[model samples]
Target: MNFKRFLKWLAPVSLTAILILCTIVQGWSAPTAAQTQLHWYGQSAFKLTTPTGKVILIDPWITNPVNPNGKTDLATLNRADLILVTHGHFDHVGDAMTIAKKTNAPLVSTADLGQALVESGYPKNLVTLDTQGNFGGEISLLNNEVKVAFIPAIHSSVIASDGSPAKYAGNPGGFLVTVQNGPTIYHTGDTDVFADMALIPRFRKVTLMLACIGDRFTMGPQRAATAVGYVKPDRVIPMHFGTFPALTGTPAAFAAELKQQRVGSRLQVMKVGETIRL
Candidate 1:
């Protein structure tokens, strides 16, 4: 073909190719629909992923007695935007400092406990004032993708230093986490059942309740079932049990109690290292 004819043919063809390439690139770069996910690591440790992919860890005792893969889970945790510590017990505060250092995730707890953790070697910069709150206070975080409300719990909280006496960390509490476009979750820190629990459902409808059913430390199956009746969550997952011999509150017992109480909530018993989509 002549040069002039070749140029004429190349112009439209090149334009068509550019348009097709642009379309393909745009499609590939577009954001995908986000789904919320939850992971339990036995005891009271739980990992929650918001629809926007922000990660939140509650009572992050990932390497607990019941979780055989606790070390693996901790090592593989790539992202953590916030770490919510309900109390200062060793089991509940498991690996918080290590995880905060690794992921640079800020600490969300009562003002006193946050300061105590900082004194106990958690990164001072990560446990800033903005991340701390007291009971009845709610903090909006992760660009408003999550709202964490500090709720009271019937338990004790003391922080013990290395080979030293235990000191008062703060009042014990639970977390009422509201995720944007996702389910609202209530993690009842280490506590026994209280009548005030009925007040929780008045504020927000609970999607899932992570309840402690271990008898010696927290509420047994009977009291836990009663607590569930008060909060009235759509689903209930038993935790803080089967880690030690004293924690004899089995899921079977909890299920039987739930049936006996005629609680409408569905009991979801998650195994160690299991992840579920909400």
Candidate 2:
């Protein structure tokens, strides 16, 4: 009613509005969110850290032959919010049960593969319907900080325990991992190049594609290059290569193939024990 009363109310309201606008408008003024981090442990194993610091491990073969520091990495890794196994192959499932037993991170995979993992010594209770899904099915986890969609991969999957026969686990698949305020990453689990990979970009643009370039098991450089062309990610990282004498695919060859295919994705070749912010 009074002029003095109105002026006091407007002053506080204007200051509050200015502060809110500053946070909303200023990109360079202050750091709004932390950058996502990615760590490679040789082979297809990777540790993805969200901007909010939640950890997701995909195909965590930490102690693969190529990673000289695998033992140390495995020993020192104490935190994992989620353990995502793309398949039931020994190499891809490496150290997952050990990590799960220690960290109690839930198993994210198809129901069959999850059951196999549980039988193979993973914490039984951690394998739940919420984290397991089939191809084309998407599940939001980590309080919605991360969302994962199972995508098809042209590969086979099986599980075996010590002194036990191998059993067919489930259909092999890859993962489309979307991190909040970070990036969408496609981890191609031990796959050959398939035509349907082109369909991935129609649903959500992939920021990074973690591709397999090992020749004997997965696609070599040339085939992987085609997969890169299909996915058309902003950046592509070659994985599952040079981990053994059999895995002769090199990043150098991969780069040449990418250039030959005229693929526009940036090739980010990470070292076995290196960590980088994305």
Candidate 3:
């Protein structure tokens, strides 16, 4: 065969080979059909698993009052990529240090609270500035698979010391987590229903809201329903309630209020240790 004829045949074959290789690479790089899983442990403790298998725990009070299998759940936590704490209270900060040490998950919180956690014996290496942010600040993490925004909350944050007086942690806040292929979750840490809650939808559409409906420390059913009316998320999951006697708010009351107030958001009352695929 002539050299020119050979080159022409080789060029077309190479082009076809290259096209096939590109298709294979694209298919391999594409994500699988893995659904995001959200597990509620009780009293605001939740484990969120992304579609790519990254795990995020928020207010990890794994051993709270309402969860019967707290110890087992804590022991079985094999993977955790991020641990987010809205405040320094024992309930919200519960088992964070242990989980971080075990999984090497970085602590994502306010700068002051992160430092306070380090001082309180949390792993110093994991509480870096890369994961810390203040209210109205947002940080992209996990190769842009997730974005966490710190939102203000009308509450107090003090880290209790063993011998010394309780130290100021930082301003209390909430978390708005936007997952790449998953839902946007808003965790309203221990806070009363504030007017600014209405502004949350201005940033992004919230898929799920973890609200606090316990009366003594946070908003009760009525106020929480009002807050839901403000945020107007697609679905609302009640949290920070039913762990103590003072937390008198019930999910039934919340649902009734939602109906009475004419809110369009759907109420999802997750059972302890239950995992919901989103």
| Per-candidate local distance difference test | 0.93, 0.93, 0.93
Q: Please provide, for model 1 over 98-199, each residue's C-alpha lDDT reduced to its tens digit, 9 standing for 90 to 100.
A: 999999999999999998888888899998878899999999999888999999999999888688889788999999999999999999999999999999
Residue 193 accuracy (lDDT) in model 1? 96
In model 3, pairs of residues that clash are none
Per-residue alpha-carbon lDDT of candidate 2 for residues 129-195, written as tens digits (9 for 90 to 100): 9899999999999999999999999989998778799988899999999998889999999999999
TM-score of 2: 0.89
List candidate 1 stretches off by more than 4 Å: 1-32
lDDT of 3 by residue, 50-169 (tens): 998999999998998788888998999889999999999889999998899999999999999999999999999999989999998999999999999999988899889677789899
Which portions of model 2 show Cα errors greater than 4 Å?
1-29
* TM-score against native, each model: 0.88, 0.89, 0.88
Backbone clash tally for model 2? 0
